[model samples]
Target: MSLFSLENKTAVVTGGASGIGEAISKAFAGQGAHVHILEFNAENGERVVGEIKAKGGKAKFHACDVSNNVQVTEIISAIGTQSYINILVNNAGIAHVGNLEGTAEEDMDRIYNVNIKGVYNCMHAVISKMKEKGGVILNMASIASSVGISDRFAYSMSKGAVLTMTYSVAKDYLDNGIRCNSISPARIHTPFVDGFIKKNYPGKEEEMFEKLSKSQPIGRMGKPEEVANLAVYLCSDEASFITGTDFPIDGGYIKLNG
Candidate 1:
């Protein structure tokens, strides 16, 4: 058998419409898994599914808000009724840029709702189906989960909770054959980054983009596809021996940056 082949498996990917989540959705479908994309952006979600289908891959788009427990549970239940959910990628999270003093109550609450509670909601919805058969859970965490980053208080707090949740779920469901893990990426070059730079830096977008890229020890920002490659391996059967680990695809920022 080909290594990391997900033939006949089913994967549910949150935020699968864009960036790293989009990359993971495509990669999973390319590997023969039937991909269920749960995205708030129906337009992008349908576009992705169409692209996958055009390439002869299996995929379906479901409009969903991961922060809502009832919505998430209902969608997962509908999907589960068709087949066992062999994988779940909790990649639907929003970022906040602010220090403690700069972060208002609503800022913290918004970050908490999407980043922390969203993960909980998706996992909670899918856990029972995973319990029926061995499965994989990959949460998108960040370098902030382990190290300090300026102006990221609320984002950091939510990611820290995600890291611990990975550990807890991995431990709690080991006997049931559920493997849980997280990926901590540093300065991924996504459209969101470009928008952030355009909005904040205005005329100096190039200068600010270069500065952000160079923050990684490797001297560049990471790619969404690179992170997706790692996600594929971790969720594949070849990685059955691994569980509860945090993989840093951070361009050496996690260790060499000091």
Candidate 2:
């Protein structure tokens, strides 16, 4: 049997419309998992679902904002009736940039709503079902959670919560056969990066972009698929022996940096 094969598994990938989430969804589908994309963006969500179906993959889209507890609970419950979910990729997140001085109450709350509470809401909603089948949970984290990054106070706090949640869940489900892990990447080349650059440094976008790329010791941004590959391994039974750990897909950012 193929070690990494996810055949017949059901997966829910939050934020599955683009960037890292999209890559994870595609990778799961490629490995024969029936994936459901939980996203708030209807346009992107539909586009991703249609593309997967076009490729003869099994998937569906549910319009959900992970931060919304009622919506998340309803959607996951409905999905449970159709198929038992075996893998969950908590990739749904929002970005915020501000130091402690600049971080406002509203900014922190907004970040918490989507980044931290969003994970809490979704996991709480589906954890009972996950426990039934001995499932896998991979939460998308960031180097920001481990190391200090400039102007990312609220963002760092949220990711820190993600790492801890992974640990707690892993420990809680150890005897029950559920495995939980997290991946912390430094800075992947995603649309969010571009959007940040455009919004923050419009005139000096190229210069700022280059600075961001070179910040990593690898001298470039990590790719979405690079993170996806690691996610694939963790979600597979091949990694059955692993749990309660934070795997860093960072481009030598946390360990090798000066």
- Please count the clashing residue pairs in each candidate, in the order shown: 0, 0
Q: How would you encode candidate 2's per-residue C-alpha lDDT over 1-258 as one tens digit per residue?
A: 686999999999999989999999998998999999999899999998889889989889999999999999999999999999899899999988789999999999999999999999989988998888689989999999999999999999999999999999999999879999999998899998999899989899999999999988999999999998999999998999999999998889888998
Candidate 1 regions exceeding 4 Å error are none
| lDDT value for model 2 | 0.93
In model 1, the worst 10-residue window by lDDT is: 125-134
The candidate maximizing lDDT is: 1
Report the number of the highest-TM-score candidate.
Answer: 1
TM-score, structure 2 vs. true = 0.98
